[model samples]
Target: MTDVVSYPKGDLRRMLSVLAALESMPEATLVKLVAKTGLDKKTVSNLIIQAGEQAGVQISKSGPIYKLENWGPVIKRSGAKMALTGALNAPIVLA
Candidate 1:
């Protein structure tokens, strides 16, 4: 049996950027964002799924649109420290 290594949490800026981009274009798929964000497809996909669950963001597999449902608290806490320096409005782009 091979040992499985756990990856660190993804950059939230990348997540939010992807989400923001998704807001404008909901038909973008995880694969597309993976290439756009320069993150591994699996990592980006998992982060997107996690964000959906934590922020109540609904993502349709058939389409690229994602709706943020009650995401105030989740977005606030989703790895903001590294991306934002004690501020939410900072323009930090995660890769």
Candidate 2:
């Protein structure tokens, strides 16, 4: 089985950068993202999907233009420091 713990940090960081770049230019295309991020087209595509899973963000495409939905910076918190485990779909109740 593929180890969920083994998720690549490099791809995460690259996607975060793509998220950042998308902020300034909200109407960029897939090809334009490759040039803007200096990441391969396939790599960018994969990162976009991963970003959706890890965070509650989405990248949508209309024709050739792409845009971000519920977009923001990805803040990585370690298990020890985090208040709760599992996806954010659960309630975030504080003690």
Candidate 3:
């Protein structure tokens, strides 16, 4: 399933890195993405939307909470998911 959608090329690694972390947690928040992935809040927020759009799902934000429902469909179709897998294995500094 993750073999379908193509992830953004080049510098989207940071975005993919964020998504990779989110993938492990059942629920997430903008603050969590920022804290966990070391991405700024505004950057994580924007990147999440961009990542979701590229992955074929809308990453919904509820105040500080964020989530992607049925993310399996979106993720399985995303090349970013693969990159995310790799990103998860790589060392990432937490904010």
lDDT of 2 by residue, 1-95 (tens): 32112214463445665665565586888888877766778987887787778775777778988787665355443321231332534333221
Give the winner by lDDT: 3
Question: How would you encode candidate 3's per-residue C-alpha lDDT over 1-95 as one tens digit per residue?
Answer: 22222334346667666666676566687666666766567777677777767766556667766666545454552676655555446433222
List per-prediction Cα lDDT, in the order shown. Answer: 0.55, 0.59, 0.61
Which scores greater on lDDT, model 2 or model 3?
3
Q: Which pairs clash (backbone N, Cα, C closer than 3 Å) in model 1?
A: 26-64, 26-65, 27-64, 28-64
Give the candidate order by descending TM-score: 2, 3, 1
Off by over 4 Å in 1: 1-10, 63-95
User: Roughly what TM-score does model 3 have, to 2 decimal places?
Assistant: 0.57
> What's the distance in Å from true for residue 7, model 3?
15
Q: Count the backbone clashes (under 3 Å) in each candidate.
A: 4, 0, 3
Q: Write the per-residue lDDT of candidate 1 for residues 1-95, one digit (tens) a residue.
A: 22211223554565665565455454566666655556667776776787777776665565554444344555653454434343556544332
Worst 10 residues of 2 by lDDT: 77-86
Q: Is candidate 1 or candidate 2 better by lDDT?
A: 2
* Cα-lDDT of candidate 1: 0.55
